[model samples]
Target: MTAAPGPSRIVRYAMAVAWSSFLSAGVLEALVFAVVDPHELRWFGAAPVELSAEALYTLSFLIFWGVVALGASLALALVNLPADEPKPQRGSPGWPR
Candidate 1:
């Protein structure tokens, strides 16, 4: 029997980011909702939101997920950057001391 192939490096990273951000969003949603009611939410501090409580919760969670995903993506990008740049020769213009 042939074994299934594992996910590629980029796929693994994407999965990790998505899962971690999902968890973070859930936690943030719980914390925020614990102290605030969705019904009481205002839009731009002028008009009350028209969404139902369930819709509000869903929307808020998505927003949280997007923000957290963005942060995770940036961190992964930084961590995946090349560790070293190509060095110039000793006699080259960009050579170090």
Candidate 2:
């Protein structure tokens, strides 16, 4: 029988998903901000509402991509989890002799 995934494997899988999500979200956010309001380029300033129709379209695209990337990464991470292991017999020592 296959061994269950240890804590390290779980953490590694989670990290992979987290990193991918972070990078994809950051890129998408940047693209949306750049297209929506080029003047509001301040990294720490409040967003401005001076966006054109083209800018809105671009922003929508960015959001779509972000959602897709997030979903894909989560799905991949979930798939990497180890399959269920057989439960130990009740009223017995935990490990097999």
Candidate 3:
């Protein structure tokens, strides 16, 4: 029989999903920013580098959603863990005895 995923594997899967959400959110925000106006902001403090107000706004939104998704997905992964799965051992018979 195949071995169930180990703790490290589950953690990796959770992290991968979290990072994927971060990247997907960033791309989505960029796409939305393309059609959005860049000057749609009130007077604000100096912006670091050459970023515009709209781009900064998009960045902030991306961070907020990304963190929220990461937390939710990680929690879901932890909560949905399989209960009492049988572990496969090395150099053993079909039953791993």
What candidate 3 gets wrong by more than 4 Å, as runs, is: 1-7, 43-58, 61-79, 90-97
lDDT of 1 by residue, 1-97 (tens): 6568677668888999999999999999999999998888898899999999999999999999999999999999888554444544556665354
Clashing pairs in 1: none
Q: Which candidate should be chosen as best, given lDDT against the real structure?
A: 1
lDDT tens digits, residue span 27-83, model 3: 766776688655653346455346678667766667866776877686776676665
**What is the lDDT of every predicted structure here?**
0.90, 0.65, 0.67
Please report, as a residue range, the 10-residue window in candidate 3 with the lowest summed lDDT.
40-49
Error of 1 at 26 (Å): 0.0
Tens-digit lDDT string for candidate 2 (60-96): 5667666866797668856655666776666796665
TM-scores of all models? 0.77, 0.39, 0.47
The number of the candidate with the highest TM-score is 1
Query: Comparing candidate 1 with candidate 3, which one achieves the higher TM-score?
Result: 1
